[model samples]
Target: MRLPCILVLFLGCGSPDQVQPEIKQLNEIPLNIRDKTEVDERTATVNDTLPEGWVDVKSLIPELVLDIRYATSDNFVGIQLYPCERCLLRKEVAEAIAVAFEALRADNLGLKLFDCYRPRSVQEALWRKVPDARYVTNPAKGSMHNRGAAVDLTLIDQNGHEIDMGTEYDFFGEKAYHTFTKLPAEVLTARRKLRDLMQEVGFKHIRTEWWHYSYQIKNYEVSDFRWPCPGQAL
Candidate 1:
């Protein structure tokens, strides 16, 4: 049976040419949180200690590899946006991620998250650089990342290498879409596997990004909460 994918109001209103997983009408907001003045550590200091309702994915499934792109300059932003590499999600969302990870391990394939629980301040930073809603979700409406309900991830093989998924993580083209099937059979199968696994665990996907998934089983508000970095004030 096919799992349900509720198109929440957060879906951005874009033309058919626009290819974003979550696009919303622009509702800009001023940021009131700390910026990247503390991200230089680039350390993964996340531990069992967490916020009241958040759960660190590392704590739940330590074995799941983290390829946090924003912590490094490898992402499309081309700069370090995160204070550190901590994949904190809402309690239930993180649990669903853990379930997906274990299920993938049964086949020697695993999960590696690229982005999770982005800070509102960072969202503003991204908007400043690429204020287009087709790629960056407006910080005002707040993407699933701000709500700790979304994840950007890819599948890894038994050798721990990311399998081919037609395009890179942040490719802004039709090739990265799940509906774009003019590619190798293996790439399509890989995308389908990741999507199926995420949906099975109560996560929903967007059309334009194969690696994007949001857990919508529960409702939550957008937040400006940045994860506590080592030697930094929370």
Candidate 2:
């Protein structure tokens, strides 16, 4: 459902109070979108704002595939954030990414945006799908994604095919670990370039998931907001 922005003071580190109660109680949250009417109503609640430089996937970039549900849906078991249709990000980040992609494109490289501006419900959906402490975070707390400052991305070739990253997005295995040093040189270089540019532009990379990054620093808080804003009327 479309929600108002929940105003939260930025905490350097969250308190014990923010710690999720327990995985056992997590089932209290709904996990599936089985009812079409309910799903439609909930989807309507999502604030589909197209931030500057953010393109509507259906119109501007339909060729890109959204494979997020593989992990959360019955059709797929892979853990990944599904693609968002009308979500957006800062124009500056988009420009920087376009420039970086230019460098790749000259050599026949392309960029694939897996997610941006995720609704909190979507985040909670993921939390319920895989509550294992090893990978997914508990929605009872928070996610960088809820802040609208992070993104999960990977590379695509000129032909629109995904480039090999040694492991899939959200793959909780050793291969998906950024510190794993056994990958090929090209894969490492690609990851490094992505990390460098994102860091340069104010995004922080998560160690466990290479594709994920966030602009959670102090200044960029202007862009950081909670999805389904709890306080505001929709």
Local accuracy of candidate 2 as per-residue lDDT tens digits, 1-234: 111112111221112133222211112323232235754444333324433333333222224444443324422244444432333454444334434444454577666776665656665766777786556656665665554556678877777787778787767777776666589987876676665555544456666777877653333333333323234432
Q: Which numbered prediction scores highest in lDDT against the true structure?
A: 1
**Where is model 2 more than 4 Å wrong at Cα?**
1-84, 90-96, 216-234
Writing each residue's lDDT as its tens digit, candidate 1 over 163-215 gives: 99999998988888777878998887788778767766777778788889888
Off by over 4 Å in 1: 3-48, 231-233
- What's the CA RMSD of model 2 in angstroms? 15.4
Candidate maximizing TM-score: 1
Error of 2 at 64 (Å): 6.9
